[model samples]
Target: MPAPTRALLLIGPLLLFLALVYVLPFLGILRWSVTLPEPGLEQYRAALTDPLVRSVLWRTLRICAIVTVLSVVLAYIVALIWVRGSPVQRLVVELCILIPFWISVLTRAFGWLALLSNRGIVNGWLQATGLTSDPLTMVRNEFGVVVGMVHFLIPFAVFPLASAMRSVDERVLMAARGMGASRARVFWQVFLPMTRAGVIGAALVVFVFALGFFVTPAILGGGRSVMVAELIYLRIFQSPNWGLGAAISVLLMLAVGAMLAALLRQARPGGGS
Candidate 1:
């Protein structure tokens, strides 16, 4: 058999499985989005015009943006230590960063909820101290949502940066040192520029992941900071508006696809970051 034919045969089962599980369901959603609710694009039209939907969309984007920015910045610092630090330091950092991955998302979200809630430990501590008399609301708001998402996403942002950082030449740094360049100068100019692609790639990944976040926002936002994912759930489950929900789902999928495409382009050789 030809190489291409053999290759196709090898992965054909996986392709068929994905088509059955993913493509078919996606097609169903696309069909429902347009044909339901008395047909036409009524559902999509409503999605565009509805103020609540618009607000959720805006808030989702805003929160995702904030999470991506914060995650990348913090992850950069973490990745720097991860790449440049001593072996003991690297092992400790890896343990701290990787622990979250082993926990379920619900567990993590609820943990954040417990920690940040009005009567939670943080607020309790503040009240115990001379900080404030009343408990400050933390969870069930955008702040809590951002905090949760950034925590979840930082590990994601770190590895790509660490990969980029690891690929940096120690000889180049030594040469810079030999030239009497300051530590800050070498890092700011030589090191950072080399890792630009990784930073952009990590940011795109973090942003895209943040866009579809449901559980964390649902738990942390406490319905107060309803993002698109939660809004979709409400429309589908609570309102029983299948058409509207499907339309929103399609739109969200498209937005995610666009971001992923940009990330892919940036990752390709000779592709401009």
Candidate 2:
């Protein structure tokens, strides 16, 4: 076989594995969405025009946006400190980020629930301190959802940003300072520009993860606050509308794909997308 053919043979198993595990399953969902209750566009049409669907989609987008913003900013700070911190500080920071990853998502969500519930510690403390007469509603709403998502996503953001920051040259910052550039100037001109790729990659990862988030949102968001993933679950298992569930899932995948495509298209070469 030619060199290209030989290479293909070597890589074929991996590609086939991905296709079988991911692509085929996804396509099966698409098929299910279109096939049930007769092979037609009705499911798609309902998914598009249904007010409840639209509202859930909008809420998901809004929460994702909030989570992305919070995670990115927090990650940037954590990454900056990690990259510039002393050895002991760096170790502590890394551990702080990694420790949460070992903990289950449900565990983290419940922790937040304990902290934010009306009669929970946070509210109890606030009331005891006379900060407020009533417990602020933190959990069981958008506030809870965003908080849980941000907590879960922060490590993802930090991983990429920290990786990117590590690639930045320390001498470059020193050189800029040596050349009489102010600290702010050096950061914006040198550090920020160099870390652009990592930041974009991190944001993309966080946003994608946030889009399909189920457990955190389900536990924190309550019934009134529903994300698309939860809605899809309700449609399929609770209501037994497999076709509609599949359609929603497909639409979600398309929406995520479109956003990622737009990010890639719009990003500059040095910037991560």
Candidate 3:
């Protein structure tokens, strides 16, 4: 066999697996969006024009944006510590971030619920310290949802950011400092510009991941702050509106694709997008 043909045969099984598991299911979703309920783009039209759908999309985008921003900020801090701190501090911080990876998403979501519920540990501490008499409403709302998402997404943001930061030539930083640049000036002008790609990459990743969240939002929001994923679940399972659910899923896929495409288009071989 020719070399190119042998290479293709070597990866054929993996390609077939992806086709069966991913490609077929995606095509099924696209088909349902147009074919069910008498077809002719009704579902797509409704998805675009319906007020309730619009509200849910807006809320989903808004919550995801918030989670992304918070995750980036916190991840930047964590990544900085991981890259710049003493060896012991770096080990501790990295372990703390990675520990959550071992825990299942469902477990983490439930853990947040246990900690953030009105009568949970946080409120108990506040009350005991005389901070407030009434229990604060934390869980089962937008605030709780954002907190859980940010916590879950910070690690995702951190890896890309840390990679970006590590690739920076420390000699450049030294040169800037040696040239009489102040600490703040060095960081704001020299260091940050070097890590620009990482920051944007981290933010993009967090935002995209947050956009499709289901379990955490469902558990934390408790139906009060429904996002796109939860709404899709309700539409498909509860209301039995598979067509509408598929439409929303397709729309979401498109939105994510657009972001990824824009990133690819703007990204350079050596610089930030």
Top-lDDT structure, candidate number: 1
Ranking by lDDT: 1, 3, 2
Candidate 1 structure quality by residue, lDDT tens digits, 1-273: 999999999999999999999999999999999988778999999899999899999999999989999999999999998888999999999997899899988998998888888899999899999798998888989999999999999999998899889888899988988899999999898889989988998999999999999999999998899999999899888998999999999999999999999988998986753
Estimate candidate 2's RMSD in Å: 2.4
**What TM-score does each of the candidates earn?**
0.96, 0.90, 0.96
User: Sort by TM-score, best first: what order?
Assistant: 1, 3, 2
Q: List ranges where model 3 is wrong by over 4 Å.
A: 263-273
Looking at candidate 3, what is the lDDT of residue 23? 89
Candidate 2: residue 246 Cα off by (Å): 1.1
List lDDT for all candidates, in order.
Answer: 0.92, 0.90, 0.91
Q: Pull out the clashing pairs in model 3.
A: none
**After superposition, which runs of candidate 2 have C-alpha atoms over 4 Å from their true positions?**
1-13, 259-273
